[model samples]
Target: MEQSQIQNHNLEKKRRRVLNKPLRLRCSVQNYNWGILGNKSHVARLFSLNSGSHIDPDESYAELWIGTHESGPSFVDDQFDCLNSLKEWISKNPDVLGDQVLKKWGGELPFLFKVLSIKKALSIQAHPDKELARALHKSQPSLYKDDNHKPELALALTEFEALCGFISLKNWLGGADAEQWLPVNEMDKNHELEAVLESIFSQILLSSKDKICQSLSKLKWRLNLEKKKRQLTDKEKLVLRLEGQYPADAGVIAAFLLNYVKLNRGEALCIGANEPHAYIYGECIECMATSDNVVRAGLTSKHRDIQTLLSMLKRRQGFPEILQGLSLNQYTTRYLPPFEEFEVDRCILPEAASVVFPSVPGPSLLLFISGNGTIGASVPEEQMVEEGDILFLPAYMEFTITSESKELHLYRAGVNSSFFQAY
Candidate 1:
């Protein structure tokens, strides 16, 4: 080979060696006020496991973030070569995101993967769509930090409760499964119902403080009487629980406006753009577009953006669909939403067994939910991974893992397969 050609070939060979290797990432933990307390928190436990540091019994650990988001950026584990941050690493090696992903997101990770330990009701809020997100960011950069839409999915790690979307008033109010909330006039039945929901939701947000207080008091009194006659329903109980957290707060009333859904382990909920939702309690795996934009109406001491949130919210009402995984292989199940940003795969390996994940279109983030195992591109150079461990897998790199426990469970977050198929 010619001298210059040989040098180019050698450089390209070195690049491949660095790009395909799995990198252990020390992810960031968020200590938000509403998080689980001390050693009881999964976030805290995972942080402790990652750093070999003692978990404080009193601190609130809300989230363990495993991505390149600016709010909770991860870093390359020190056992390997030291790196500044996950974001920095991605910027330096843009091809690690894959050609399609790199071109779409400009050297950024499109999805932010998280583990949330919710002890209280989160803010009653909605995420704007892409166009509105851009407008919101341009108008109020301090509040809406990014110009990206956040369509998130949550997979239950335990028993999880959340208020998602609006409830079907026709069924809940009129007790008519196939009837309308209001008498059908000239308009379409669905559109008519949507208008009613929109009107009621608007009134709820626009209610005056004194009016809110009186409504809350009357509702409490009625609930007390109802409880004397019979046990309160779960939705009714949720209202009382939230009242203790934020006395007479607007979010307490939100229970009536939104659908109360409970998810058992392995089930998932997809929160699309403009859908109103709040995580009530329990631990879950959350993945979304990389953005920190939230338009909160209540249940927070922070500023409320009622008008903005109202403008962006969907008025349709019905029970949202619960997602179950489809088997991808003998050891893996995948959950894919109708979105282009991301998808997740759950992998389970029996004790003393092994499986190889086929090469995927883009880089992915993996979290070991339980069990200890060895993972790598190949066996001899494998690294040990236990519960709470996080690893970054590069694009087009086939990965192999072997379980050392009774059963191993882990979730992998990656770009949508459709993105690659299009290319």
Candidate 2:
């Protein structure tokens, strides 16, 4: 071959390689008692994936971890080659990520991804903002970091319930019931109480337990009351009983806590950092920034960084609001959050459906939650997909899904300008 022809052929091959190469990743599940992805045990199990523990068959399940975070690197080859810890990988590979992602997030993967199954409530806690996380990590190298900020979104695999954000202060101040005095609501309307709580948190940071008893004393009084018979539902009764057991549970006083949102199979909710939340029950397809930095206040026996958590807690009150309103298209409904880390969409196909995704330059994660279907990519042959199966789609690839059963439900994860703009 002529030298010029050889050079042109080499350049064409390199271009094809760059265009077809994508960073999409899939995670293998670990085990847990509730074995589903949403249990407390599952949280530990999920961490085990990174910790390199044996997958406990007695109590374990698995989940895929996608995104550019460094804590848990995805297995890139048969021998499990780890990427440059997640942070370092992004720094070293700017040419691969390009200017779009780098401009918005400095070449770091802006989000974490996971599939969680919850059999119980997570901790009743919140997350520190980026500034606070950095400061805490600096003062005590053991406790915090810039990447510990956890803003999460969960789409239900089964019905799901979680306490998210704070209820509006107006909701608490409107009533003067025994429930209102609960610790979670003590600062509901009174700016003094908020200030006092804040002060106590700062003091606790210095290891002073001076006001701990006083805070718990007032909280216990409100929690010891007998169940009210004034027309409260069964769930309300159970919450009050829990308050009785742990009067210090600020979750009890938040009437918003009494609000049990029933998310059907495909619904979703986004919980931001420093937003007090607890997943009650049921299974969910959860995705978040890939960090396990949780500061708990109550509801579980996990480590509780009381002072740090209190400092991070947003004192504002009201029922937790769902972020990124749900948008419905002909065959899909999307829950778009204000953050760029993750975006989820649920597609319901009756009989058969065809979707032509737009050409975008980012990887995508797709899960077939229910029914059966065939997914066709650039290749002429179609791949059969079923409930619980997941597919990773590379950038700039167009795909179509056709249902073979009565109904096919699917979830898609991708990046769009809308997510970046919201942030």
Candidate 3:
């Protein structure tokens, strides 16, 4: 081989060495607040936790992270000590991440993949956009670590409930006295929706505990009395549930003002920067830009950053439009969002049928949500994957997935290209 040809040959060998096989990943589970209590969580079951597993019966299983986000980076196969060192390992192998990602994001992973199991509602929160995130991180590095935006997309694993964005409070406001319910200040009486919302939140935060309790008690009595006259709506039931979980919580009161959404299995909801939302309950497969920075308003024992949250929120009216995945074929459906950082797709490989995934600009994280199957690359190497298993595929590495069981369902998360191009 000539000099350039010899160099190309060596590069081809390195690519084959690294990208020819799928690397089974061991992800880290996060036992955070607001998670489902006990091992009854789908996350726990998916991870195969039994009576012998060293898990507290009362501990909440919050999230199972399957990416290189530093908080809970998944490990490469057989690299037990590299549990949180996958990002560092990828730094050494730039080819695995591909040139586009390396050029755009350096050695860092651009997205974070998660399996979230929420029992109690999460805080009423919104993440900052890229510009704001950069400023926030610059000013408060202790709270916001990364200078990147966090736009999230979540697909339901179970019947999922959430409070997302503002709905027109006009109808609700007309029936009741906004002044009595929200205790808005005089200056905010004629303010825009944004300022009015801020005032309402501020009042809720500043009100005496006894006053909040009294208000909640009256509201509960009214709902009960109304129920006797007629059937309660879904929104009313949601309010009751929120009250049951966190009585007199500002978030419960705030929840009454937001859009209530229910996502069935395979349905998705996208929340962009500054779109306030609270995951109420259920299991979900969530993907987001690589950041954990959240500004919260209420509904938790965690730190409440009301000022920061108010500043970051969009302060608009109406529920967000839920995203529906468009099928590429019988087996594959792509969930294309507007953001450039990440795209997610679902594949259901049927028994005796297979689907080939072509190359992409960046590496991919494949999560086996259910069923059993075998996956192989161009090189003929194959491995079995079952429920809860995760595999990392290097950039430009083509692969085929086939089902040995009845069907195998998998979700793939990667940096967007073609799908985004059309959108």
How far residue 332's Cα lies from its native spot in candidate 1, in Å, is: 1.6
Arranged by TM-score, best first: 1, 3, 2
Ranking by lDDT: 1, 3, 2
The list of candidate 2 runs beyond 4 A from truth reads 1-25, 30-64, 68-72, 76-98, 139-148, 173-235, 240-262, 323-328, 379-381, 419-423
lDDT of 1 by residue, 1-423 (tens): 999999989877765666667878888889889999988887888888876778888888999999988888999874334666888878878888888898888889999999999998899999999999999999999998989999999999899999999888675665421112122234333466557666666676677877777767877787788889988777778888887898867667755768889999999999999998889999999999898889999787888999999888897789999999889888998999888889999888999889888888689999998899888783248788899788888788898889999999999999988778888
lDDT of 3: 0.79
Q: Give the CA lDDT, 0 to 100, for residue 160 in model 2.
A: 71
Give per-residue CA lDDT, model 2, range 1-423, as digits (tens).
999999989877754543343322334553433345323444444345333455444554534455554445443311122443434434554544444666756665555666666554556777666677667667765555344566778887676776665443344345433334433434433556445434333333333234434544554443454334255544445465555545444444342333345576677777777876767666676776546566776655556677677557776544555543365668877877766666777788988777655545655667665688788776557777776455455556777788999999877777644854544
Error of 2 at 125 (Å): 1.6
Two-way lDDT contest, 2 vs 3, winner: 3
TM-score per candidate: 0.91, 0.70, 0.88
Cα RMSD for predicted model 2:
6.2
Per-candidate local distance difference test = 0.84, 0.57, 0.79
